[model samples]
Target chain A: MNARARLLVFALGALLLGGAYMAALSQLAPLGRGASAYADILNRVCVRERHITDVVTAVNFDYRGFDTLGEEFIMFTAVMGAVLLLRRGKDEVQAPQEDELTSRRGRRRSDAVALAGVVFTAVLLLFGSYVITHGQLTPGGGFQGGVIASTALWLVYLSGSYKVMRQVGPKPLVEAAEALGAAGYALVGLIGLFQGAAFLQNTLPPGSIGSPFSGGTVPLIDIAVGLEVSGGFVLLLLTFMEEVLEIRLH
Target chain B: MLNIFCYSIAAWVLLIGLYGVVTSRNLIHLVLCLSVMETSTYVLLTLIGYRVGGTAPVFADIPVGTKAVDPVVQALMLTDVVVEATVMALLLALAVQAHKRTGSLDPHDLRALQG
Candidate 1:
């Protein structure tokens, strides 16, 4: 189509969309004042049942835990798909000699960059652990913390050669940890099942609300999810990096 | 008035993303446009969840009678964000493979499947 016609069509489409959106917005109940169907119920029950301060965590891991399980599997499947798509094939030429490739491509390490990477990695790892463990008490949780933790591995890749990264995090070990993390989450849910409760039921005792030890299986699920996310992200990065390095063939 | 503003802005963002996707020549640009659409949804949900004078829903240091913003939408948005990230990563990976196989990033050029 001509540019004029295309622009006219686009304008018409936008106008229609705007009208539809306005209509929908007009029908929506007033914000903040509109009563949620189950907010009050959840608010009352969540604190009492989970004894957790962060109601969001309670909702995610307990109230709607089955949904969270599906979310975890979504991540799992996406990473698995990435691995399958990016894996080195039989026709791809493997690096015959690691030392030769390193000597050829590896630049002299910058002390400043290496030092900064190490400091940042350490800080991120600690913060990630804190976020994952204290998920029930704080605003952040496993997903956020896991993404942060994976950045440490990314920094390792940035500051050092592939060889150093391999030494620090072997591919097989990371993959296994990813699988284990996903499985561990499922296993936690199964415990609820074996206890004659619903899947992902909060079987363990929820301790005092504010303490780190509270939230029972919530914290454990958070840890498992954190591990899975960190490993998945790191693996995704490694595969792309391998492609960049020509370690994997086109 | 504030609700109108927030909702309109969200709609505008979504429309802009849609326009970009419709006109995007490159796959990477299309992916970015998709992200913009996702972000618009996030903004809409957040705005919907906001209370006029409510504080965060956390029980830390707040008065007993103080109103707090809705926590359910926040929880849902959290999961949505993770899903968006995963989907983006997968799309980029597929884009990489497409480029490797076809030697082009343009949707027009990637017409092998077209009948």
Candidate 2:
């Protein structure tokens, strides 16, 4: 359909949807007055039973861990599919790939931006790792931290350190990390099952509250998720860069 | 009655995003419109779970038994964001591949599937 026709249809649909949404809003508890018994229970029991300071982390990695597991694999499969879609076809010439390498040599490198990127990469990595490891303690968790860490991987390229970036996170290494992350999560749950407890149970020692060792399997699961997300995104960035570079050269 | 503001904002965002998607000629823009719609969902979820005087669900600093907004929806939002990112990346990749095959980024021009 033409653009105008499509807009007309959309306007009609929007009106209907808006009306339905307004009708539904009344059902929602007023702002900041919503009751969540489940949240209340988790908030109360998490620290005492799971030794987790962050109830969100407890729910994600413990109570509803299976959901996170599914989410992680969704990410893994999406990355894999993206890479495949972006892959150089069999008949595609390898000439443009090498052309980009030589072209980079003649390109102007900015010392100021390079310095800034270097500083940013270091700080982002430190903060990201802190977020990753401190999931049980803080509101941040593996997914949040992993994405932050992945931006650090991007900064390595941004700072005119493309060669170093490639050296640090090659496809094979990133693939392995991503795979291990996906597998490790499943294994954590399996360990619970093998122990005759419920799958994804808080199987590990609920380490002493407020300590790094606390939250039993939570920290372990968080680290694995961190690896998975970071690796997956790095792989994604690398694949897109390669494609874009070839497009630019050709 | 004033509480409707947050939900109204969410609804407005959703409608705007849908309008963008309907009018979008470029695949990348359409994908972004979808992300905008997802953003509306996140807003709605947070608004639904908001509690008066609630702190964050973490008890690391606050004393125990402190009231906090719902953690469940926040957890859902986290996954929602990650999935959206990866899915957006995948969609963009597909767009790239489509362009490579058809030499066109305009959705209208690419409507006919070619083997």
Candidate 3:
């Protein structure tokens, strides 16, 4: 359709949607109530049963473990798909002439900027680890922490070069870590099965609430997810950067 | 009411995102519009779970009787955010490949399969 016609259709759709939403909002009950039916049960039993002060983490890693498992796999599959789609083709060849072009365009880095990047990356790595490990007790969790940690790798790339990144961690090792992380999540779930509980059942002891070592298997799952996410993201970045650099892949 | 205001803002965001997506010409712009749509949904979900006087759900220093905001929606939103990131990554990757093969980023210009 033409631009005018498309705009008219979109405007009409928006009007209808907005009207429906306002009508629904008017009919809804007032907010600021106590626990919902679902939240009520969670509040009543989650702390005592799982010994986790963070109900969100408990719900994510324990109460709704299966769903979290599926979410992790979704990420794993997406990363794999990206790798497969972005793979270097057999017909493509890298020439040394591109290096000259890149070098000519490359700008000199300042010493201060490089130093700041290194310092910030170290701090980010530390903070990310703290976030992942403290997930059971705090607001941040595996996914958030993992993404933060992955930024450190990006910082290294930004401050230096692709060659520096490769020296920091080889492709095979990073890829292996990603696979291991995904597999480790499943392995943790299988442990519950072997212990006579259903899949992903938190059979380990739910230690004291509000402690670092509490939450039974929740922390373990968080660590596994953290590993998987960090590895997957770093690998994704590495692959994309390689493509940009026209690096050969065999 | 404050709740109504929050909901209306979210609705506006959603509508704006929809409008952007419908009118977007470049593939990159379309992906960004999609992200805006996702953000609207996140805002709606978080606002729906908000309690006027509720504290954070953590029990670290709060009294047992203190009311807390809904944790279920927060957990769901967390998952949604991660999914959004990965989805955007894959979409951008596809856009890159399309640019490589078609030599164009505009949807109207990509007619390789029209025949």
**Cand. 3 Cα-lDDT:** 0.81
Weakest 10 consecutive residues of candidate 1 chain A by summed lDDT: A95-104
Could you give the CAPRI-style class of model 1?
A: medium
Output per-candidate TM-scores for chain A, rounded to 2 decimals: 0.88, 0.92, 0.89
DockQ of each: 0.59, 0.85, 0.64
Tens-digit lDDT string for candidate 1 (B4-89): 76678889999999888777789999999999988988888887877778777776455434577778888888987876787888
Q: Of all true interface contacts, what fraction is found in model 1? A: 0.48
Clashes of each: 0, 2, 0
What is the docking quality class of candidate 3?
Answer: medium
Best-to-worst order by DockQ is 2, 3, 1
Query: Lowest lDDT 10-mer window, candidate 3 chain A?
Result: A95-104
Q: What are the per-residue Cα lDDT tens digits for candidate 2 across B1-115?
A: 6899877899989988988888888999999999998899999998987889998899999987999889999999997798789999999999998888888888888877687
- Measured against the true structure, the TM-scores of the candidates, in listed sequence, are 0.92, 0.95, 0.93
> lDDT of each structure?
0.81, 0.86, 0.81
Tens digits of per-residue lDDT for model 2, A97-191? 65454336567668988899889999999999999999999888889899999899888787755566777678899889889988888888887
Better of 1 and 2 by DockQ: 2
Task: Choose the strongest candidate by lDDT.
Answer: 2
lDDT of 2 at B25: 83
Superior by DockQ: candidate 1 or candidate 3 = 3
Q: Residue A2's C-alpha lDDT in candidate 2?
A: 82
